[model samples]
Every structure is written in structure tokens, then in C-alpha cells.
Target: MKTSSFYVAFDEAHKPRGKIAGNYSHLKEFLDSQGFICQPYMEFPITRQNLSPYDILVIPCPDFAKFSTNEIDAIAQWVKEDGGGLLALSHAGGDKGRRSNLSELVEKFGLSFENDQVLDYSKNFGLENLPEVVNFSPPHPITEGITSLCFRAGCSLSTVGLNVVPVAISNEESDPFSTPLIVTAEVQEGRVVAIGSYEMFRNEIPGGFEQPGHQEFCSNIFQWLKTEYREKVKTGEIKPKVTIQEPTQNYDANGITANVGSQPSFISAKLNLSSHIVISDKSDLANLFHGLLDEVTVLKDQIKTVIETIVSSEEQILETQKATESAEAATPLELPPNIEPLPVPEPERLTEMPEKPKSMKDTKKKTDTHLPKTKTHQPQPIPDPLPMTKEEIEVELETLKNKLNSIENLKDLVESKYKNKSYTKAQYEKQIERLSNDLNRSLNRIKELEMQYTKGKK
Candidate 1:
């Protein structure tokens, strides 16, 4: 098999529902056959320094979590400056369905995922979730030679900037006919592709890798996504926007530059505490300390969960990866006939997502609080509910608590930025209001979870 320098990283830090080797081994194998190196990105905080080595980053459906503001900025900046390729994938019903905020990150590239699944009853592959789509728009490299392909249980997408283009659409027979299903962008020196369905790349599943034209389409996507800019960075042609190399100070508890430095003594170090941030009084400083402590707690829980997931799944993950080595020998799992009744996706609970704020320093808006709410929840599909274990319930509760902590930390960080006048009053108000809504939603969701747990116990 031929190989190339194009490196692809599948993010594993944010609790993605699909593991590369476990669920996307087919994708890994395909990319490998094309000479691309694939690896799981498990680095925490997602700093530019950590991402500098790769040409492409793929986020495969983060579940029940939100990427921190710092991490999002890092990713966005990496793609725009370092010639990185970002391929953020989501499932049916989009971010709202998964209880995640991937659209938040991809919006930086002028594309957003919709909260509706594409369904075609008349034109499907044995089932409605497996929508047979053949719509290709004005010729684009990514859609080259791709006539028909399986959309496979995925949501839709919308584009904004002129640089961003939609290459594929839903058939007139499907729900929301002709809407964008795959959006791409030429952002600065980098490239971005956002697709709603990650399932199409799975191994031995209906509407998956075996879907006739899928392999050809996959080749086109990778060939287009493998940006030449990564090679530029290697030859010292450009510098990354993130400046972590010089004097290192990873994100402080506030996810911003702080007084903390790696230097041994304060005399030679660049002191940021007294210079940049205006701590009105001792009380404010105390509050900062308290916020740091809370942040520490959140980080601890995050690390614990990541470690536990790795330890628990280590063996299985390795076996799955090893299984890929002998893939040619293994007979593909026979896809079952579509006799099983179509599983109804949970009714989508829609949230009014505010239009993307034009600028980070955007002026005060006329209305901030009463804005529409948006959500994407992968319903407990129409299939029979599986029995839940006590451990599962406990883990869920912990996850909810951790999310609450993260929101609080984000609130504090934004407020601190406001205090320093880094954000306009309007920007601050808008962020705080959104964070407030997130807090309430997380609280309500916790109650709902507890009730379900109790009902199960009974």
C-alpha cells in the first residue's frame, strides 16, 4: 500500500461517541490504504502546540459535553493559520440531539449543522434512516466522481460566508428537500468540511462503508481535505496563530493568559497578574482564587473520566485495532435484512440558536435573554429501552455535575474578560445570558435524569 505525509487525527478528548478503531475502523483502514496516517487525538485542552503536527482533525460526535472556549479558539485558529483541515462530523439531529456543542466550533469556519435528520421514505436503502441521496451541486473537488451515496442516519448543514460552499444536498423526496448536507470552506490558508453523518464510515452496517459509491466519495473528501498548508508549516513558511512556543503558559484556570509562568523565579518572568488584570480589591482576588479551586475540581473529574474510559476500554480497543490488521481475512459481518421495523428517532426538541455573533467584540444586541433555545438529543430511539445499571446512573450524575461545573467556570471566565473590558457590554451580556440558560438546562436535565433513574430502580 502507498503512503503519504497527510496525517489525520480523530479527537478522543471530548468523549466522542464513536471510537476510531472500535466504530470507525473501516474509515481508518480506508485512509490507511490511501497512504494517510491515522491516530486518535487524546490530548487534553486541545492546544495549538498539541495540534501542530497534524494536517487534519476529525471530531466525531461529542456526546453530553461542550468544548471549552479556549479549546475552540485553538482549533479555529489552527485551521485558519497553520493550513489545517478540520472535518467535524455529527450524527442525526445534529448537536442538539447529542447534547453537544460541535456547531459552536465549526461556526468559526462559516458552517453550522442543522438539528433535523434527512429522511427519504421513497428513496432509501432498505430503511428510511438510510437515505439514498444523489444530489451533487456545481462541481467541487470533494464531490468529484460521486454520483450517488448513502446519507446514512445523518443531520443536515447550513453555510454562511461566500467562501463556504455546500457540495451536496437532500433529494426532493427527503424531508427538507434540497438543503445542504455537506458544507465546505476555504478558510484563510486552511480547509474545513462539516458533514452530518459519521455512520456512513462504520464497518459492516447498513448504509455504511459498503454503500457502493462511498469509497470513491471518501477518497475525494480526503484528497480535498489534505491541505498543502501542513507541508508549508513543516518548511517554516508560516507561523501558527497560537503563541505557546516562546514562553509557555498554558491556559490558566480562566482559559486565558495569566501571571503563571514556567520560569523558576518571578524576577525574570513576565508578570501578567498585576499588569493586565485589574483586581479591584482583595474580595475580587479572593473570588479569583475560589474560581480556580472550582476549575481544579472540574479538571479533576474530567481527568478521572478520561482515565477510567481508557482503562476500561483499553483491551477491547486494542483488540479492535488488531482486528483491523487482518481485516482482509475476516469475512465482513452479514448485514441483516431490513425486516426489523424502522427505529423512530426521538422527536426532536428544537432550540432557537441565535444567529452567529458577527464579531467577538460584537456590540450590545437589542434582545439577549429571550432568544430562542436550540437542542439536539439522540432520543432513546423507538427501539425498546435497554436496562440501565446502577453504575451507569451514577456515571451520568457525575457527568451532569461536571457539566454544571464547566458552565460555572465558563461564566466566571467570561465575566473576568468583561471586567478587564476585553469584551463590550453587549458581548458580556449575551454570553452571560447564554451561560445562564445552559445552567438552567443542565439543572433541569439533571432532574429528568434522576427521575428516570428512580423510575428504573422501582
Candidate 2:
């Protein structure tokens, strides 16, 4: 197979600075390793004829301000007619010298470069408080595997049209209301991926080398370009299969070969059958099956862990409920006894006797009468009803049932779909096991809730 060729057209007048250059150099090495022939535009003339042979073209952060209108138009026409890929990166839009021609190029593809430099103190990257760290949209393949990226100094972009796909986003940290990054139009029937920050490809920024999605973005773009070229080849559309045939020999009853052609036909059939079996073995189907099984095994293990965690939590909740119930039951309730009242007829006589007697025994009796009697019985404080509300219990039960049902359905679906395809059996089993674990966790949760409800009723 012929290797795909790529041409990287960087404007020396507007080329990416410092780390950006270094990063591009690294990208070049990476693509070369993948069997692509990469050539920088700086080493060649930036003309339509010069770029015609390349499968992919990249205009990396070109200082369009230096390019004349005629120069920009030439590049646009080349892409339109030849269907070669184009990547354009720009700085803040107001820099007329650099942005003028580049902006024009992007516009031809239904995209516009915004003239604002985004300042986001909230999402700033470094300790210096510059908003270099930017978040991206999770949906696009270019942004896949990238959660956050740091760009030294980057601009924002805007676009319109179905061909554009927003690869990244600036959160509240950039501008409260601004679309920060975008990819515009399809390339040679494939899409052109554009990013707002030229700094994302620079090396000086911390994590520039290790940033999530950086490598993937570069790789995916080139791969996409290669796919476009491959689709162009008539014979490359599908791979051809090999066939083998066996020859046969036959003889006439007269001991001399009467029909030599008949003998060859008989031998050909047997040989063909043997060759077919040999060719089938070379398909590497076994290796493909093993790889799929391995993936499934890993998935199954993850599911098991999740289930265990859920079960442990459910048990803890059950134990807590039981302890609460025991504590409530152990609390004592006491009722005080009633006392009888003495007769009141001796009130006047008692006053007279107290005045006449000054003896120790009489003094003791008077002190006892003056003291207030203690009451024994007090009603126990009423216990409040169990804490679980009706709505809460019903919701818990419903959730548990739903989780179980989901798991069962998933397991059945996987098993039925993958039964005949055991080479990838692990993948299906892994999904099934994961679903089963989820169901088990739900069942455990349901049990815990039932226990709580029963205790509350008691």
C-alpha cells in the first residue's frame, strides 16, 4: 500500500512561536512513524501547484496579515477544486496583518474568526491567573479523551453552517457568553477541524505534551485525511479474498488416458477445497476473538467491584436501622403511683396543739406536716412514629425494582445476541455480568428498605 502524503503549510511571518514550533516538530515525527510523508510549507512555495500532490494540507497559525488577497484566493481555490484538507489556526482577530487573509480563507468554508481575546480569571491555567486552561466540548471526536487543555494565549472562534462541529468550549471562565472553539466545513467530503487556540499545540504550557486528547486530535485528523484518499482508490474499496483449488485426474477403462481434461478437473476440486480451508485459517479470526474476550473480562471485573460496593453500603444502612430500633425499644416508660389525701377536720385543733407543745417529738411531727409530699406517677413521653415517610419508602422500592429489571434485560440481550459469536463472547458476558451486578445491588437495597419498613411498623 502506498503511504499517504501530507503538506504542512506554516506561515513564517505568522508561524506558531516557541513551543508551538517544537510541538509541530514532534507531530511531524509522530506522523512519519505512522508511514506518512510530511513536508513543511516553509520549505516549499505556498502555491496551488506546489500543494497539489499532498493528500492533506495544514495552515498552522499563519500570519495572514502578510499575505495579499491574491495569495489567499489561490489557496482557497486549490482546496475547492482539488478537495485537499485544510487546517487554519488564528490568533485574536483584530491583528489585521496576520488575520486578514486567514479570516478570508475560513469564511469561504462558512466560518468566521472572532476578534476577541478571551480573558477568564475563573478558568485561568497557571498560578499567574491567566485563563490559559480551557475546557472543551465532550461530544466531538477531536475533543474525545480531553477534559482540560492549557494554552499559553489563545483566541475564540465563531461559526455557522451544518459542516461545522464545535470541538471545544470555553466555560464561564472564558466569557460568560461566548463560543470559544469550532471546526468548520467538511474536507474533501471529510470535515475540516479548527480550534480556537494556537497555544494548544504549543509545548511551553504545562501538560502540553501530556494533555488529554492532544495526541488523539493530531492522530485522528491525519487518519481522517488518509481515509479520504483511500476512499478515492477504485481497487482499495474492499480487500480481496484468496481462493485455492485442487486438480483431479481420470483414466479410461482401456488403460490409456482418454480424456486428460477430465482427470485435471477431478484433481482441481479436491485441491480447491484444501486451499479454502488453509486460507480461512489465515484470517486471524482467533486473535480477534481473544482480544474481544479480554475486553469483556475487564468489564466483568469492574461490574463485580461496583456490585460489591453497593452491597456493602446497603448492609451498613440495614445495621444502622436495626441499632436505631434496638435503642428505641430499650428506653423505659414509667407511671407514678397515686397518694391518698388526709382528713381536714383537725386544722383548728392542730394549731392549738402546736402552740401548747415544745417537746422534741412534737417539733419533729410539725416539720413533717409542713414538708410537701412527692408525687410518684408521671406519664411517659410519647414516642414519635418511625422516621421513614410513605413517599420515601415507595420511591426506594420502585427504584430497586427498576434497577433489577434493567440488569435482567441487559443480561438477556447480551446473551442472546452473542451466543453464536463466542470469539467475542467475553465482551457480551462482561456486559451481562455488569448488568447482573447492578441487579444484585438493587435487590440488596430493596431488602434493606423492607427491613426498615418492618421495624418502623413494629
Candidate 3:
């Protein structure tokens, strides 16, 4: 059994829309399965003293409450000086719509949430708000193995140069082109990640935690966030304590129940933490049965809370409303189906289609000269009789090399799709065969050009 080493705290104060016991229960369960200690911090006015016990702090979109400047400064100090990981999530329309100030807290680390929702009408899961993102630029750790992600009713993020960077971005067809969907920064000794969409890892939906790349994305972000500072925290290298009192609650390893006027809770799926006891006789068996009955009672309450949160989930509808408004505002210029806008008119106008030659005898009387000559296309370029110059050889060689580069790039793209399981074995092998043939031909042509160019130079 993997012992819990890394401590993770979910900020439940300031009235966050999601919590461990409710909308985010699945996320809590997943982390618990990984053997991480998950808890909720319900303490008010988040201070450095209140944050000392944990290695990572996740603030999942405070609804309408704003964090005090002092609290923000303390959180920043903890991350920079003491080496703690910070993950902040926000919805669409950002601070203004949510009536919160998460941007101010994250701005200290060169990241901020934008007042916008990402939408792609051409590509999505039934609606424009759920934009499917395939573009991962510059290849950072958070997006390492992610091929695609659904940014469900989320906003976009902005980052400053160098210190902060975007790992994932929206598709080309999205409203905001190539804007950052996920941003990360490494400040001093700690790490910070800000995501526009919190629902990207929410319990269950089309573009929820079950999305193909999202689980891997969560793993990557957490692994990167667990810095050397966290390692030291585990080793007891530094003994920083939370001086402020934390709300106490029983840790239910199986049930993972957390509620208001309650501490945040997560179930231990991997770590079977229930106290071990030997059932030597009838008395021990009776005691175990009593405990199991008690567990069933707690689970019922947890289920009730989960249902309530789901119904109340996104009460403001800030992200969805904002996304809808954006969609309505930007109505695409779509032409009627099956007809494309033509820049130039066809060769012959509609009236000039040869008149159908009234009859065969009339067509025979009409000379072939009336018909337009169909020009024959030649695939190969006509050769010059004169000997070629070295400059011309150099130009041809460069062009052939460029063709070879294009072929190689296509090969890499196909291989990546196969590795990600996006392509079937048969499709992969067939494409590889065709691309390999093209690849060999390009290589041979380039080789011939190089030889000709060299001989010409000589």
C-alpha cells in the first residue's frame, strides 16, 4: 500500500462554487486513490500561518467573495519563500462576472484570468461553449501527454513573458484564436498553475473529468507542482505549523464526506486506512458489523450533499451565460450548403453551355471549330536545351530539400496520432506505407539534385 506523503488542501472558505463533498467529489476520490492526503481548509482570511500544514493549495473559483490583500500577500509568501504549490481555477467572464478577485492573487506570479469564454462553433461537444482543444504549443509539462482537451464553459488566461507560460490553447476556429487555456509559473522555489476552466476536471459530463486527456493533464500538473519544497515538508526538514485553528472533522477513508460547518474530506480509495483488527471470536465479528452499519449511515448524508451541489452548480451561470452571449454576438458568416463563394466566374456563363445542338443532324452541320479546344495538361516541366547554371541547380536543390522536410513532418504527425491511440493499427500501417514511399522518393530526388549541383559547381 502506498502511504500518503503529499498533503493537498482544498480552500473551502470564501464560498467556492465547488467542494470536496459536492460537485468536486470525483476529483477528491481520484487524488485519494493516488495516496495523497486530501483535506479542506475552512479557515477564514487565509494567512501564511493557516496555510503552513499543506504542500499544495487549490482554490476552485471563489463565487463572489474577494480575498483580502493581506491574505493574498501571505499566500504568495508561502509559495515563493516556503515552496508551496498553488492551483487556481476560474470560469468564464472571469473576476467581473464572478465578482471575485482571483486575478490579483495570481498576478503576483505573472498569471491572470481573462474576462472571456472560449467557444468553437465548428468543433465542440454538441455546443459552442465546450471547445475541443488540440493545440498544445511549446510543449510544457502540464500538457505533456495531452492530445486534446475540452475546455467546458471556461475562460481564457493571460501570462507575462518568460516567468509564466501557456501550455494549452484554444482551436483555430474558436472565438479567441490561440489564447492560453492553461498557464503555469515557477516563482522562486514553488510552482503555480492557473486554469480558465474548473469543470475540465469536474465529476461527470461530456467534457468533464472523464474526457480522454484531462486525467493525464491533472496528473502532470500535480506532479510538476509537487516541488522540492514539498519533498522537504515530507522529510520534516522544516517544521512550519498552522497556528490558526483548523476545523476538526473525522476522516472517513471510505466515505470521504465533507460539508459546511465541516472540514473538507476525501475518501482513501487506494490506502485501506480502516483500523485493522483480528476477528478471533463472535464478539469481534459483531463489532465489525456495527462499524459497517455506521458507515452506511454516513454515506447517505454524503450522497444527499452531492445531489444538492450538482443542482446548485453554477447558480450564477456566469460562464455559460457569458459563453452564450459571446456566441450570439459573433454570428458566423456561413454560406448556403453545397455552394462556395467563387472569386472568379466559371469559364463559360450559364447561358453559354453550347446550346445542346438542337438535333444530331444540326450538330453534324456545325463544324468542330465551334467547340472549345480542351488543353492537355503536362505533368513534367519542359527541359531547357541550354546547359543549366549553378545558381539554378542550387535553387532546385533547395526546393527538393523543402519537399523532403514536409514529408518528414507528416510522418511525425501520423506517428504521434498512433501513439495516442487516436489511430487504429491498420490505419497507421497503411499511412506509414504510403508516407514511406513518398519519403523514399523525396530522398532519392534530393540526392540526385545534390549530385547535379555538386557536379555543376565543379
Candidate 4:
């Protein structure tokens, strides 16, 4: 296998800089173990002439506020034409003071870093109560094996005109509009992998924080970058093959027994029952058989544990569903209060009329006879309606209380569902037990089979 080479770039004027400062050291060590030669720019000045020698170029979180447009353009053009892989990391230092030139560099590949920190209480990493959990979307090769990763002081990322693929997402409880934890884009001829935070690869995060396949993730990037180089030297792929041989038949008191040997043997006897036999190299065949048996045993235990965990989870889900249904059923329907009908006035008896009023001309000669004719129909004031009955009010209040209680119950159910414990511990324990038992059983079985085969041969 040909080794891959990577050139890491860092800002010169910045302190606490260089590849070894942050996650770079972790990345370098991981790549080196996979037969990659990582060269840091700080060790040798980064010039256009020197850049052409590297297969991949990595830019760590740098204080790029002082870099001129020409410098950014130079780096961008180099990546676009040479088809070299680029990695851009962001941190608190690069986000503050002046506009980061790193932002301009990433913009060439159609990515941008937002000047805001992503704080997610739900996805936070570690015990410090900071948002650190990153949710991956699906099975992309780059992020296929990573479910969640720990990050410290992460920023946000956004994309522009390029077709960017997001690798990880912040929890919903975090800033919804902020950048994802990781993003990538394929530009003119090169690819760019952008990491929003540098703390993920830090020394304090612990090595085992990532999922089972994260080490492969670290290797894939470098391997992808050096794929062309590796292809030139690769010969042929190696694959394992298996061949089964027929065994000789021998009749014995224990029904019909087949004589299984590494090589075919000549033996004649009447068979009580015909059975297909297999033969192969004793050691190789035994090892393969033992491996399969071990795997099967392990699988059985794993399946059993998984079934139990699924059953428990299903029961919890059912309980939550029932609670939800009850809460919904208990919701009260409100009805408008009953209106009282107005009382009809009783018929009044006609009263005798006195003398008729004098004419307007006769009244006008007397005192102020211009008194306005009284309104023929005067409007009567309506009486205020009585308040609703105490019973009615109590019934309405009780309905409201019931409605509130139902709402509270629904809220409780939701919280409980989210707070429910996961099957992590139980699944892990089962897996460990199953694997251990299978290993032990396989060893014992192999020993017994070897002894039996040896005795039969003699």
C-alpha cells in the first residue's frame, strides 16, 4: 500500500497555533498510524511552490483576520485546479476581532461560517452541561459510523452556491438557524470538509467518545485524498476461498458414522443411513467451523438481548401511548351558558282621561307655551340581567380545571417519553456476555472436535 501525504497549513502571526495546538495533533496521530505522512506548514513556510507537492491541504482554526484577499485566492485556486482535498476548522479565535480570511477561503468552495456559537442544551457534550452532541443525518461514508460525537465550544456553518452535504446537526434545542457541526462540498475538482468546531479532536474529549467506526472516518478522508496515488500501485485484491471435500462412510453400532478426515480415506461398510460428508484441511476447516459456531452463538445471545430490550421499549411506548390517549379522552368540551327568556309585561287596564290639553296658540299667550310636545313614545331603561347561577359557574370552572389537567397530563407524558432511559447499558451487557460465552464455547468445542478426529484417524 502506498502511503498518503498531507500538508497542514496554519497562520504565522497567530499564537497557540500550529497543527499540534488543538485537534490537529489528534488528527495527525490518527493519520500517521494509517501510513500517512503529515507535514505541518509551520515547520516550513507555506509558499505556492511548496503547496504543489502535497496531496491534501488542511487548514486548522486560524486567526485569519489579517490575511489579504490575494492570500485567500491563492489557496482557493490551488485547491480548485489540483483536485486536492481541503479541511477547514473553526474555533473561537477565528470568529472574533476581524473578519476571518478562512471564511473567504471556504466561500470559494461555497461554504461560510456564521459568527454565532451553537448552544444546544439537548445535544451538549460531557458533564459540564454544554451542548456537545452532534446528530448525524444518515449513512454517508464520511459520517456513516458516527452517531454522536463530543465537541467543546463549537461554532455554526452555512453553505452558499455549492452542493454542500451536512454530516452532523445540532440538537433542536440549540440555535435552529446556526451552522451544522460538520459539512462538506465538492468544488471544481477538489472536495472540502468543513468542521464547525476544533474541540472534537481535543485531548480532553477522551478517545472513546466517538462511535465504533470513527477511526475509520478519520482514515477515509486521507484515503480518499490519496486514492489516486494508491490506485497506481495496487496490484490485486485478496479474497478468501473455501472448498469442501467429501468424507468416507463407515458403519458402526452408533447408527451410521461418517469418517471425516483432512484427506479422503478408503473404507467400505453398509450404511444404516446415507449422509453427506465434508472434508478439508483439519486446522483450516476446524478454525472456520469454530469461527462460524462462535459467531452463531454470539448472534443468538445478541438477538435474545435485543428482543428483550425491544420488548421493554415497546412496553414503555405503549404506556406512553395509553397515557396520551387518556389525556386526549379526558379533554372537556365547553358549551355556552343557557340564556334566560325575558318576562312578558302584564296587560294594563285603561285609565279615565281628564280634560284635553289647550291648543298651541292659546298656550302661547299664557306663559312659556312653547314647551316642546312631550315625546309621544318615551324609551324605558332596561334592567340589568342577573349573574349566572353559582352551579353553572362551578360547572364551567370544573370543566376548565379538567381541561387544564388534561393538558398537564399530556405534557407529563411527553416529558416522560423523552426522559425515558435508553437500551445502551442493557444492550452492551448482553453483547459482552454473549461474545464471552461464544468465545469460551468455541474453544471447548474445537478442542473436543480435534480430539475426536484424532482418535478416529488412529
Question: Best by TM-score, which number?
Answer: 3
Q: Give model 1's clash tally.
A: 11
**TM-score, per-candidate, Cα-based:** 0.53, 0.45, 0.55, 0.45
Tell me how candidate 3 scores on lDDT: 0.73
Candidate 1 vs. truth: CA RMSD? 32.7
TM-score, cand. 4 vs. native: 0.45
Local accuracy by lDDT, each model: 0.72, 0.51, 0.73, 0.50
Worst 10 residues of 4 by lDDT: 238-247
| Winner on TM-score (1 vs 4) | 1
Show the lowest summed lDDT stretch of 10 residues, model 1.
Answer: 257-266
lDDT of 1 by residue, 268-314 (tens): 32212223444555743653454445435544544454455456577
Write model 4 residue lDDT over 45-118, tens digit each, in one string: 23444455455666656632334566666667656655557877775323552235667778777566756556
Off by over 4 Å in 2: 1-23, 43-45, 97-100, 127-138, 187-190, 210-212, 227-458
Q: How far is candidate 3 from the true structure (C-alpha RMSD, Å)?
A: 27.6
Among all windows of 10 consecutive residues in model 3, the one with the lowest summed lDDT is 263-272
Residue 43 in model 1: lDDT: 69
Off by over 4 Å in 3: 1-4, 236-249, 253-458
